[model samples]
Target chain A: MASMANQGAPERRPGIPGTPGGQPRGRGLSMRTRQLFWVWGFLALPVLFYGVIRFYPTLNAFWLSLTDWDLMSEPEFIGIDNYTRMFSDPEFWKVFRNTFTYLIVGTPISLVLSFLIAFALDRIRFGHTFLRALYFLPYITTASAMAWVWRWFYQPAPIGFINDLLGRVGIPQMAFLNSTTWALPSIMVTAIWAGLGFQIIIFMAGLRAIPTTYYEAARIDGLGEASILRRITLPLLKPTTVFLVVFSSIGFLRIFDQVYNMTTNDPGGPLGSTKPLVLMIYQTAFSSYEMGYAAAQTVVLFTILLCVSLLQLWLLRER
Target chain B: MRTQILMAGLLAGTSLVAGTAAQAVEIEYWQYVYETRVTAMDQLIDAFEAANPDITVKQVTFPYADYQTRVVAANMARKGPDVLQMFYGWTDQFVGGKVIQPLSPEVFPHDEIEAEFFPIVTAMKRGDDYYGLPTAVRSLALFYNKDLMTKAGLDPENPPKTLDEMVAAAKAMTEMDAGGNLSTAGMTLDMGGQDHQWWREVLVRQFGGEPYSADYSQVTYNDAAGAAALKFYTDLQLVEKVGQRGFMDEGQAAFRAGRAGLTIDGTFRLGSFSSIEDFEWGVTELPANAEGVRSNYASYFANGIGIGAEGEELAAAEKFLAYISSPEAMKIWLDVVGELPARRDVALTEENLADPIYAPFLKGLDYAKTTLFIDEAAQRQNAIDMANRILIDGQSVEESLAQAAEAEQAIIDKAK
Candidate 1:
């Protein structure tokens, strides 16, 4: 059936100069063929780019995960050894837990915070755009700069803003970034805050996309504000919520910049308390130069990202 | 036509200029960016360029954190600098990664390098080849604030000469606020910085435990002496309460802000500390243990020719490396960067030894041990983790020491 339709396409397009039924098709390419030619011509560069730049390295990483390549000598095949080593390593497990902690705690907190802000800002007429821009400002700022600023805010009295405030209230000084227990959460707070701007902007756009008519109809049906939000606004915003759930989940899972910049001297430190998988991968690959081990970590992270994203999409899918 | 003749003459002029420019060999040199070091390097480059007109040197720098990664990436891409600066502890990794090549004996004879430079420079030697050379070397010393010492009712000029004396001075200087939090740290305790080095090479040895075997193939700092060293370090904060981890963010910062009475730092801090106005700081030898045993960690960043260079570029890099390691360059580096010269003849002079600020650091080099690190970052992280385990996680010193030893041993094994 598809072939029959394709065969009829050239005949149906008689107005096109190069169509078989309209002109001498032997001298020039058929209209359909030309269209395909143009499409492929435009696609060739990106295809070649992804092939060499992205896909090749990605596939090579999978191969490298099975071999021992220390970025110096020729890679030697050592199948499953990297994976076994990663599994047995206690540090890897610590980093694994840290990575998930970011995803589990960071995603929901950031989403809810951004949603609340967006919802509140949506109703306000005065300074709405200004407020939106203010929230979005952090997203545009450099991650390292933001992380450093947050680091300063966590410093002890006379230096850190938070500590000075706490000190004024006769409260004991808190070790925000320095404490092993507090360091991960402290870094997570920064990561979530850094991502809040982007999430808020996205949520606002999603809210705006929810037609006013849905809310109006719901109100006409005697729905309260809360009821309307629960039924009409939220149901209509499923697509946006799904996208953000996956996006923010992936972001939290791959959190690196904030943690790294915050703990620049000893990244993933205070005893590897805040290390995410990506940071671990970076340290293994760059610091330790254990390419195979790092590659295995990367593969694990890639699998987690894939599973988490898929699971989120499935859970949030419209029934 | 007249236009054709003019065009031809213009083309000839451009070619002639290009020909002349091509005669001058240009080589790039890379180092991590520290203000004084960069300035000193620029000065050396200027002098070197003046001396060798045919060779042009371009100085490139990256932030210290990103410098190693950049060098590795550049090496992998085959676009590395002609000469690159690297930490002495990175010698093994750099040699294994082939990021740097050994100096040719014809240009930098091993006998001369061994005889002229400080004995510690042998850290760069692998087998019979010397992979790099340093213009200046660094050793840990006790940096004390004179005003803070005076305020604590201690003699400002006579810094602590013994561990017990240092602890006493620290306790005297420590000040608590109304909330019982440290308002001023008597001593800055930063495990993430030079404290790790001090704990490994200085404290461990001073306590009678070698950090690593003589061949550097085994971990040996997990014994009783190692635990004692670890206890002494942590006790400075935990028991005596003279210092706090993460005080004023970093030990150097606390000392810089005059909130810290003393900090164990390397000679590299000399330039930065000297620049602080109204800050009366003094440098003294690291305090000896009760047995009067003293040990220190001496380290340096050495200049090496990248493996990427060949032929003319390689030759130029060799000459540049030679020039940078020369006595003249070492003197300039010492004066400008405040690091002790790498050569005994240049740095061990009566003037340098008698100079109050440099004397302690110079004296430290006499018994200083430079740990041959397999992976400096990982090994440093082990030390940092050991300290954190005791300080933060409240782990036992013996347990932490054992864990650190095992971790370091694994790293050495993996490198093998």
Candidate 2:
């Protein structure tokens, strides 16, 4: 019957008369099925994975903020108590202050230095890759090794490299990591050194992406190099700038590994100067085993991070 | 949207069937001893299996650095190690929360064993209730390079009898090359060893000051004796300039390479140094701070054995522990492993105490003092760390001790 119908299309497939009327509709249905398969297959796995690993945990953590659970027993619902205690925690404010201090002082300095280097590299004629790799080498180096090297450099003794260099120029030995006053600043220096590489790379990429015609147009208009950078480069690199700014804020806010490793988790050590917030949460959770309290701390940290990210998006996000 | 619906339906369907499934009784055990020690632990499992085969012991060893964090995370997950090793400093945190199983003399019968072992061995316990058992015991003893002492005109047989004599002899024995680098130093302090507290606390005790008060309510070291002790230690670095920072400058290398005269450390490192043959070394008692006061805290590297509350392999776990601590088995541990015995009777044998190398360490145990088995051990350690930093880092002795006192008081108050 199918062969006869194909051969002649006789009487609109009389054996199954309604099928002819539904042919275009059936083809449309199959097309929709194919579209759904591709769309769901490509997109669903990532969404599910993200939901379970990141989003669910974050949401559960926030929900956990309203309860008391020590990971042993059933969670007790104690609404707003954890949040309430956070308001009065002196250590919270101190840690928050330390993080802000690091971001405020360290980030801008690193960004500016990286920008200058990138600008210079863009203008250089010879050994550009070598110089770029040289500038970027420290970033690629392992954090533990770099931290140790920086520690040796910041050693509080006459034998310290920095101190010895200073002595050559008639300056006395300074306790870079040992003094309460100098320890935070010393860490900031390390942070700036490590961060500058990535910033330079990002800025260079943005610079490269900018059309040469913009510079040519500016030159025809008799604009200087500095003015062109400010007018053409800076304004056009909004996306990159916002990207760096938001990412760096998140990085600085969650700066626990450096603070913990560098300071050996000594609270108020060398005068309680390098105590950052995330470090406090770690000390509370693992070192002290105050999970419920640590959970409380984590919720506050999340809130702070979330608000900052949202504000940055609001301020710098393109329409 | 269809995928989400399908996933939701599948999950709901699974939940309905999950209500009828049997839950596995999970038991977790965490230890720091890895490699052969883990294999040695299996002998206990065999014995446990023979007794009551229902329970299973899932043993794991974490790296030293991550052990604490892993345990904490496990606890947070509501599935922490049913039995875990708590160090000297960390014991109090467990006891403070009452999170650990209490081994009373009634429950585990450690009364005779406790008396036989050094009093300080149970320093982490509270009364008759102990959170764990002493798996390894350690104490500080003088380790002298016999060749260096003899070459420097000091009798190798007769080590320093007094602090003054030690200082004088160290000064005499110390030699410097023409270039003025430390070619051979007379003595250096072991500041980072597990047993360092024994020597440091003993020295402080000699000056007539206890680290914590009799009540455990105050840190009493901020006063005159504490100041004197602090000054004396700092003088070794500042005024005398005799000793090097043992932690920063590797003491083992100094000893093996024949650059050091005298070093003091625990018996545990004896295993690590058993193969060092370049120099002849002898062990002796640590120098007394006073003429006679034996005021050292005993340092022990211990592992606890306990049955999981609802573990499937409870019988197996207990049997494994018994097998490991047996006389024959523990002898293998003591002789081959070279760790000092947690059992006094096993320790006194010809292989352990009678040997020339091990005899002097045995003798030093006579003068040893142990820490009080209190709940606030870690807090005491924090206070001690402050005191150590002050003395070693050239901070004011009085101020450091005072800060330590303040810190100790706060911790004590919280514990109470």
**Poorest 10 consecutive residues by lDDT, candidate 2 chain B:** B307-316
Q: Which stretches of candidate 1 lie above 4 Å from their native place?
A: A1-27, B1-28, B53-60, B308-317
True contacts kept of 1: 0.57
Tens digit per residue, CA lDDT, model 2, B108-205: 56776566665555665666566666655666677788898888888988888666767766776677544333456777644434324643377678
Task: Please provide, for model 2 over A99-214, each residue's C-alpha lDDT reduced to its tens digit, 9 standing for 90 to 100.
Answer: 88887777677777888899889889799999999889888887767876776687533335786576667666576766667888888887778777888899999889999998
lDDT of each: 0.89, 0.66
- Candidate 1 lDDT at B150 equals 89
The global Cα lDDT (0 to 1) of model 2 is 0.66
By lDDT, the best candidate is: 1
Q: How far is candidate 1 from the true structure (C-alpha RMSD, Å)?
A: 4.5
Considering only N, C-alpha and C atoms within 3 Å, which residue pairs clash in candidate 1?
Answer: none
TM-score of 1: 0.91
